[model samples]
Target: MLEILYYLQGHQSVYVGIVGAGIGALAAAIALRRARVAVTVLEAAGELLEIGAEIQMTPNVSVLLQRWDVADVIEDSLVQIEELNMRRKDGTLDGHTDIPVVEKALGRPWWLVHRAHLHEGIAVTAKRLGAAIHTNSRVVSLDHQAGGKVTFDLCRGADGLNSIVRSTLFPDVRPDAKTTNCAYRAVIPYERIRQDSIAKELIQKQTMEVWMGCNAYIITYPISAGELFNLVLSHHRPEKVYATQPDVPTEELRNEYKDFDPRIKCIVDMIHETSRWALLVTGPLKSWSSPQKNVVLMGDAAHSMVNHMAQGAATSMEDGAFLAKCIGAVVQGKLSLRKAITLYEVERMPKAFLKQQVSFLNGAIWRLAHGPKQQARDAAMAPDLEREYHVRSSNIYGDPQTVVDVYGYDVKVHAEEALEHFTNAEKDEYLGTGIVPGLEKYMGWFMKLPANQPHSKL
Candidate 1:
């Protein structure tokens, strides 16, 4: 018993090197740890600093964290929002949806939380599960090999948008400048506006509010257990520039949303700091894996899309889960590493592309300035007192059933099915070899006697 324990401790079922230690990387690490595979996460940053950003954790993503046993660590830090409200720039209600109703159809509650807090939770889970995460160890290059011992390292590219792995894999694939948008992000402390009567009243009740205008829109929600407000504004911008700098002049931000709702402007004025990001689209990769099939891309590296659908992180989380499941199967000898990587791509690309389109459409709808087009959009989303009626009236992007379909996906089951398929193929190959080889000598002898074998004719 002691010898076996020592061996288990000394030997890893598989060695995996994951680049980038963000939500997706950490989640992938933890998922592999659950399968008892040794994982090392290499983050470019020297330390995991608190990025003052907030993200919406839809039911689809929350369910996966729960499955991975890290939900408790983040539950206290999450703001559970039950409602989603959309309004015209003047603050008139355009449409609304009940998050709880969507949650019921999806089987998990939607959460809003600080990006840093969620990262910490995933890091903690990864550590507890025995995955080693190395900070400041950026992988500038990759060296992959197949058919090696279990102890050999398998590279996984969980790197973010500007991924070196992705660039090296497909040089021709570039983000289309026409499809890009610019986002202004801010996370303001609730204390900044607690003194304002209207702002205070607004934050008292948990809700996600989206104010829409011509060619731009704003999404604001409570995060960090309602201690802060997360605001994001995306506008159609043609510049291909990518810049993230703090202390961006307030006037610049205000200029973008100058004609928005007064309340939204008021909230924007309260923001002391902000980051300007050029949101780049990275979906429909020619392939998410290397030709060798020894290295695979996950998360943003695989399919980076705009945040219009509030699914940037959610889809990455799904990528982590699916990739981990496939890699775990390889570690357990259920599938070859190459086969697993192929299955990962086959199972993920179409789904990611669909999500990419939905997100892009959402952005287009939200950014409609004014015209018959905008009017038709408003008419289609005509709200009703009944939640079900309102949801049914909304388009595919806003409909609750779309949420259910996207969130209800179970990648683990799909991974198992993929492994079973390959398993059957492998079995058939082995059986064919065994049966045919046994008849080799007889085949030769029978062929020699078959020149005129009328006696054997049926």
Candidate 2:
């Protein structure tokens, strides 16, 4: 039996034990504390340092951040994306989408910021909201039995990719599968980019640019308030081993994209150091909670997906927001702990799984071979470029429906509606009867409307 290191309020009321102190964990703490739930986070690291490069915050999770009062803290650091440019391999613009117009429709702006700044802001907000955070406390084992000297109403696993909580709960589940694709990340100073005329044009636009080619693509955007430009190069590598190498040879990086546009080559030449990481994604799980319902998973621990859609962080933060909403119902005596967790899994699992598949598919679309199929994709997007109102396109960013589904979603509102449906079903004696009377009608209301529909606006 592993000893639980932290105890809250002598177990007098509902308490949550959270493992891992990443963005998901901190977001959970902030939301739960706002809901008046006691939380204690156990972090494995002795000291939390800056990790990762830039991250995109789509409206789906950005709305939650605003509600939690976190956006204000990191506002200055966030770069509001004005446009997204989709280009061919040689840097010819295939199409572009106006982010401000989309932002106006969605009621939230898509933001780009340094991952470190976002993490720090969430951490500060979590601590300020009265959540206790413990460092150097690695939880090797969790005691799930009740009536222990140290017990929790719930134990949440926000510990990412190699989640001990996920493995401990379902030991028979297979490990996450490594995709054939790998990505190299590098950051160049905006000042250096300004020296090159072609590259300088990129910074001036303040746009997120995606250059696509055969089995490969590059995404670049400004972060840290336009001081640094973040670049990510992703390509298929069937023979490469799956591991994270902090310093891959710069020559290897240049050679991989030697045939790409000269503008891209100029930027690549300036990067002296970069990291290569093998992309891995977890398969869909049957459930995100334990049989006992006291132990649950969130974020990458629940559904780790590739980053092609730039929704990994968005979806992870969305999980934290939705989970907190479900658990908050339990705190308010509106639902039992078991049912609350069930509602969470019921509402979130399918959505996360769909997003995972979409991310994989988006990669395939962006990396199509430079042939007829690629030409068709480019042709499909050409009309949207000239249209005043962008519709469905080969480029996911330009497709208004995908934008609404991915960026315009409001998790909190959806969670509340889910709770309402659950409570109504329970009252109508439809819960245990294997038939939810009003569920179909409720689901119809939940389905996303077309982009042109009035209800599509968040």
Who wins the TM-score comparison? Answer: 2
- Worst 10-residue lDDT window, candidate 2: 433-442
Q: For model 2, state the Cα shift of residue 244 in Å.
A: 0.9
Deviation of model 2 at 100, angstroms: 0.3
Expressed as tens digits, the lDDT of each residue in 1-458 for candidate 2 is 01111223333246766767788778878877887777778787886555789888887887877888888999889898778888887999887888898889898878888999999999899889998888888877665664666566567776677777777887776445456788998899999899998767677778898989888899999999888899999987756535687888899889889888888888988989888887777668998877888777878878888888888878888887777787677767777777777877878887888788778877877888876566666665676567544345666775776776777778887887887778888444533211112222211221233323322123
Q: After superposition, how far is residue 443 of candidate 2 from its true place, in Å?
A: 24
Tally clashing residue pairs in candidate 2: 0
| Model 2 CA deviation exceeding 4 Å by range | 1-12, 145-149, 427-458
lDDT of 2 at 81: 76
lDDT of 1 by residue, 1-458 (tens): 00000012233356666666788777777877777767767677898654658887777788877888777998889888767777888787867777777778777878888888898999999998988777777556544443434333345666677777677677676655445477888877889778776666567678888888887889999988898888998875555656454667888888888887777788888876677776777758778877766556777777778888878788877877777787677666666666666777776777777777667767777777687566655655554323434333333334644665566666676566665665677444422111011222211222234233321112
As a whole number from 0 to 100, the lDDT of residue 171 in candidate 2 is: 77
